[model samples]
Every structure is written in C-alpha cells, then in structure tokens.
Target: MSVVTVRIPDTMDHALRAAAADAPSLNAYIVQAVRRQMTLDAARKLAAVDAQAALDLDGEGDAL
Candidate 1:
C-alpha cells in the first residue's frame, strides 16, 4: 500500500481520533468512513435516476 499524507484541522483530527478509539487504526477508520460515504452517494444518485425515470414515464403516459 502507498502512504498518503493529509493535513486536517486540529479540532477535526482530535474528534476523529476520539470517535475512532475503538477502531483498530486511524487509517482503517478513515477507510471505512470513506466507503460508507461512497455507498451513500451511490444510493442518492440511483434514487435521483429512478425519480427522473418516473417523471419521464408519466410524461409518456400523457402523450399516449
């Protein structure tokens, strides 16, 4: 694995460390957080696409 350095606000860093006290490592905690965010983003995008498809279908029904 490659090493990446990031600079964060001290308060945020402290909060993360405290929240992640039960985690095995800070890196693992950050990775889990990022993965969770990605999943949430994907779900949101899927919902938006489904909503648009519903709207399109409704318009089609009106034209029929």
Candidate 2:
C-alpha cells in the first residue's frame, strides 16, 4: 500500500506500457510481474525455511 517512484529508459517505458495494455493498471502489471519473479527465484533456492525438500536449483536432483 505504498507508492514508489522509479525511472527507466524511454524504450523500456514504451515496451512496459505496451505489455501492460491488458492489465488493469500499470502498477498492477508491475506488481504481478514482481510477484511471479520472486516466486520463481524462491523456487530455485536451497530449501524452504520450513524444512521442505529443495526444488533443484543446483542442476541435479529432480524437481517436485
């Protein structure tokens, strides 16, 4: 529920607005994208803090 200000290159801004056309708002699109990236990053890590099995970030074990 906080507002943030950021700066980006003009080309990137153009692309972002085009991509966000289907989203309810530019802010919502960015927020969703951030959440998805964080989820993928966490999924690639060593293990969950609750003692769950690792999800195979090291290019070895089979993922669940």
Candidate 3:
C-alpha cells in the first residue's frame, strides 16, 4: 500500500470528519467515495457510447 497526503480547507476538513464518523475510518471513507465516483464516471461514458450507437443504427433501418 502507498500513502498520500492531501491538503483541504478547514471547512472541507470539518465536513469530511463529520461524514467519516459513520465510516470505519477516514481513509476507508475517502477510498469508497473515490471508487464510487470512478464507477459513476465509467457508467456515464458507457451510456454515451451506447447512445451514439443507437443513433448510428437508427439510419440503418432502411438499409437492413
């Protein structure tokens, strides 16, 4: 495992601590949050690709 340090404003720190209270640890909470964001981003990209494929197929109805 690797360790990284980050700096945030006092207000953000306060909010993080407050939210982490329900989590097992602050580090774990941050990791989970990052993982969730990554998953959401991937889903959004996939949806865009799917939408484009649908548009491309729409004009193929007459060709097929």
lDDT by residue (1-64, candidate 2, tens digit) is 7777767688799899999999999988989998899988877673454556533368666665
Of 1 and 2, the candidate ahead on TM-score is: 1
Off by more than 4 A, model 1: 1-4, 50-64
lDDT of each: 0.79, 0.79, 0.81
Output the lDDT of residue 1, model 1: 65
lDDT of 3 by residue, 1-64 (tens): 6787867688799889999999999988998998899999987876777654564556465642
| Candidate with the larger lDDT of 2 and 3 | 3
TM-score of 1: 0.68
Give the candidate order by descending TM-score: 3, 1, 2
How well does each candidate superpose onto the true structure, as a TM-score?
0.68, 0.63, 0.68
Model 1's C-alpha root-mean-square deviation from the true structure amounts to 8.3
lDDT-sorted candidate list, best first: 3, 2, 1
